[model samples]
Target: MNTSIRRALGTTALTTAALLAASGVASAHVSVNAPSAAQGGYTVLEFRVPTESETASTTAVTVELPGLASARTEPIPGWTATTEKDGGDLVTSVTWTANPGAGVPPGEFQRFVVSAGPLPAQDEVEFPATQTYSDGSVVDWNEATPASGEEPEHPSPTLELAAGSDDTVASAVAAPSSSDSDTTARWLGGIGLVLGALGAALGIGATVRSRRS
Candidate 1:
């Protein structure tokens, strides 16, 4: 093969391998998401747990919520949920245990949902989790990311709290609105989307050609 063609093929192969590896490891990391959660607000939180063990199933999970005002877990048919509260009766932690033969199997995942909180008034919140496998092993997803922002091998589930909803709405209402400006912005956004799609298509075509060569 010519040098250029060989380089293109090598780049494509490396890119493909990187993507596959990322996707493979991503699910193995337990994570949480609450897109609309705001400071001192109540919102639904979803904690997604994946069974990372090749030979064992996930049997239990425990999440720490030290300052949450309250929490309620959405019931899973084959799972039982419990909470522990501090002296002031605020939920401090929650645990979910899978029933017999109901553990999340290897390569599969389950999302545990919670409707909780007057969330703590903090910029970031971490929900450190402990995972138990049916094979009598436990894993802690409790490491805090350092100031350098490099993710730890088993990073804790975290959420960055936004400003309260009232502040957001007030800010939006305070912004000047103009039909003409809105129209122009939408037109530009549409063009950007079209260009982005075309770029992706060309990228795919180039990769396919490199592979077929």
Candidate 2:
């Protein structure tokens, strides 16, 4: 094989590997959309859950709220919402369940919204969640964030709280729009297609070069 063709093959392989790594990061675990809130203020937050099971639909999701916060859930048309409280009237957790046969199917995702706060004065708060599937399997997204900044296999979704200021407070609850989600999905799909094409082209080029040699 020529040196130039060998270098091209190596470059293509590296590019494809990088794209795969990025795609994995983008969709690895349950995440919060526009996950920022002001310290000691009210804000709405959305938990974005993607269905990961190939054979099971996601039937329910439960999010454990941060300590002793006042919370109200936004209604989702097809799901029923319930709250679990600790002894002294502090809302501890919230669960949303889909009606039978109406859960989020494979290859799709759903968002659960909650209006929660006055948020804690801390820099960040984590919302540990439990995801239940139609086949009775459960995925617990309760892993604490590591100090090394590497994501866990099932990391909990988190919201960063900024020190309250007039301008920061106004933009704290910027929930992601439907169009934004759609655009992200489209971009990921496009990258996957490009990577596949590059892999096939490289394979064909290698085969042709071998035959000539």
Candidate 3:
């Protein structure tokens, strides 16, 4: 292969790799899944936790439920769910402990569900979580989202509370949709394909030019 064609191909390959890496990072995070819900109603919330440690599995997850009137956890097999309450008899936090060998392993994730609310009047709710690994490391996802719209390194999972009737809120939580990460991945993949095609065309043109020289 000629030098011009080889350089074009190399550049294209690098660009493609970068796009794939970005897509992976975009989706790797602890998140909450709830499509939409009313401001002052009840809804089921699912906390999605992904195991990040290669050496250990995710053994436990504790989520802080600030500003919530009440919450009841859904039973998960192989995991024990516990709740912490304050003097007001309101739940302050919920923790799910994995049974022996039941923790989420590397490259895997688990979702813990809870029926919570009398949703507050706020536009959104942030659930700060502490993830514990079998290796004894802890990850605190407690950062509040900033006004600049940039996500933090360990951002607290947030659920957007939309304006709807109480009945709508009940149905909203029943049907969870694709996350922001999925949408981002699709967009990135499309751009990568276009760039890759352009790179291949350039490489072919370069080869033709070299041959005519």
Best by TM-score: 1
Q: Report lDDT (CA) for all predictions.
A: 0.87, 0.83, 0.84
Window of ten residues with lowest summed lDDT in model 2? 169-178
Q: Over the stretch 18-130, how does candidate 1's per-residue lDDT look in tens digits?
A: 99998878667999999998876788999999998999999999999955656999999899999987755668899999999898998899999999877766788999999
- Write model 3 residue lDDT over 95-174, tens digit each, in one string: 99999978999998998999987676668888999999999999999998789998789998988988867565554444
Q: What TM-score does each of the candidates earn?
A: 0.74, 0.70, 0.69
Better of 1 and 3 by TM-score: 1
Better of 1 and 2 by lDDT: 1
Point out the worst 10-residue segment of candidate 3 by lDDT.
172-181
Candidate that beats the other on TM-score, 2 or 3, i.e. the better one: 2
- Candidate 3 residue-wise lDDT at 100: 91
lDDT of 2 by residue, 5-119 (tens): 9999999999999999888666858987644577767788888999999999999999998644467989888899999876545678999999866899988999899887666
